[model samples]
Target: MVSVCRLVGLRAVARHAVLVIALGTGLLGAALVALGVVLIFATDVATVYFDWALVALGAATFGVSLLGVFGSKHESPPLLRAYASVLLLLLLSLIGAAAALSSLGEARIDAWMEEHWERIEATTLVVRKDQFEALLADHVAALLTLLACLVLVLTFDLLLVWVLQCSATSRHRRLRGEDVERKPLRASNGAGVELEAVAP
Candidate 1:
């Protein structure tokens, strides 16, 4: 009875969590698509590039969310695993990006400062070498902060992917009418009940 109750409770929680994640993904993808469409009409080439990037990301996210929804509903282990794998890759790439940004090249920093120096000079009443160095440091810090936010988001998404996989596994086993928690029985119950499970 305890096992049955625990299984039921877990399934209930997992089902709701999966639904929330699926819905969130769908909404976020849709928003990105909308943003891309808005940017597509811009005259600037940079905006055009950004639009395409957003569109591609939105499409991929939409497809992944579709797979997640379908797999959760149908209890497909392969689909769930695939989704998890992709999310894992995203997390890894975000980590790599953060690392790269933290170690950004001095040449690149110098070039950026060179480009912005005129603007900085015009805006400031006083400017010195130390002030320029401080500005460069601040810009680097800002970039790192942005990358950190992205990494956090990726980490959270990966966690949700893990939950989705577990939910799919649970549903699959339950659909097959397998016990949620089962231990193999031995010939006789002695001082030591050698425990083993035929887990899926």
Candidate 2:
């Protein structure tokens, strides 16, 4: 009974991990497509480079997730671990990229303000400064949102990896006939009869 329970638990964990990987990859791919569209239509050439970088990262993550799913199907621990490691590396890369883009944005905004202070001042007096500030805030907010999404996806991927590792370990142990707990059984004898109880 205990062995059956463990087997069922292991299968459930593996299935959950695969599902998470698949969903994360699909969502990341769609997000990348949307970001690509936004970059082409809304951003300038200078910022477009960063968007391209993010698109590549997203594509790589999607590929890794698919690989993880396939590896899990084969019940290959080494392949699953490799896929997980790649995902961790990709997550780190995304963090670095987000930090770099934030720094670049700050520098660009400072430079823009420095170069167009006089024009901006005149325009502010003639036009509604609130509208301009709102636009700037919206852009920054969107960037932050994207970063948050990346972080969340990375976290989910890590969790899936952990679950997969645990399940794989359990399965390996079971395959090696190590699932049963063994212990010395106390023996009793009465009137030429002997009995022993197994601890399972």
Candidate 3:
């Protein structure tokens, strides 16, 4: 028979999941840092700088994962709040990125592609403008669609966890009678005081 402590509740599962996410995030961040180190030695200055930026972003993500893992495991309010705030910021940033991408309309995409067509054609001369455009369009669409799905899933999961945390906290507070809201009713003469019902 399984022990009582071995049987986990939804909250327990969520807490463990946070640690798992943290582990994965940390690994990804390490990989990015390694990649950035390699890229920094590349001959292309611009590409090296771009890789550095990715490394920075990866480091930030890794930090968030650490905070999330610690918060979830220890049930630390401050850490949990910080993790939630970071997720919110990431969600907003993703939305902004999506908007910016969408704003790069078809005309802009075509124009941008045309500007680089010479280099692209040098690699595959047989590719026609229309065909290349169509392929690029499809590729971009697929990427955006996948990213949108990911964002939606992340948003839902994070929101659910945050809500659950807040609800659990409030429930505990109420149980401890610390969540009682006392309403004061005083007479105009200030001779008497009335206490209204306290709602938790």
Candidate 4:
């Protein structure tokens, strides 16, 4: 019975790890989407902001994943939980920064539009009003898409963290030593082999 419980606990932990990895991947996707949106609307500024932001987010996610992998391999519940929290925070911060940047971009664009309305109308302004409207519409759509991605990423990360914490708590209860107990093997004589369990 104990062995069976241990096995179930381990399975839960494995599932949690998979979830964490999936959330991490989602965060990366969100970052990429944000970068794409910035490039589309504010190329020059985005080139500078997104380049560093991407690098920071990528490195942080990588580090968190590495920690998680190590924690799983070693069966360290505390370490796993810690790393999961770190990943969650990093994702949240990334989303917050992206939102701030988007707001700043919108403000700047609004200011420019107000200041240059007459000049823009007087100058070539090659693009027609409809075309300009279409472009602006596209930009808004992209921004919204990026925001959605970020929200999804954050939600997934939080879910993963919650699952991991639950799994860790269950595993901690079943912990033994350096190794978890396994199902007994049937011997030729119908005897079962017993094994020692490990702690978390």
The pairs that clash in candidate 2 are: none
* For every candidate, C-alpha RMSD to the true structure in Å: 11.5, 11.3, 8.9, 11.6
lDDT of each: 0.68, 0.68, 0.70, 0.60
**Tens-place lDDT digits, model 4, residues 1-200:** 35754877645655555556655664675676566565547654333344555656565656666666566555567876786777677677768866765776655766666677656545524445556555765687577677778677656655655566576677677664323345443335335655444322
Q: How many collisions between residues are there in candidate 1? A: 0
Per-residue alpha-carbon lDDT of candidate 2 for residues 60-129, written as tens digits (9 for 90 to 100): 7577767777767766678778877877887787788778767777558656756886676553333355
Cα lDDT tens digits for candidate 3, 1-200: 13532586556666666667667777887788777777668634334246678779778877888887777777666777888887788888778877877899888988888798876665534557788788878788777786697588568647645854775576567756753454443344465755454443
* Candidate with better lDDT, 2 vs 4: 2
Over 4 Å off, model 2: 1-11, 23-59, 101-105, 108-138, 177-200
Model 2 worst lDDT run, 10 consecutive residues: 121-130
From the highest lDDT down, the ranking of the candidates is 3, 2, 1, 4
TM-score of each: 0.58, 0.52, 0.63, 0.45
What stretches of model 3 exceed 4 Å from their correct place? Answer: 1-7, 42-48, 111-138, 167-200
Best by TM-score: 3
Better of 2 and 4 by TM-score: 2
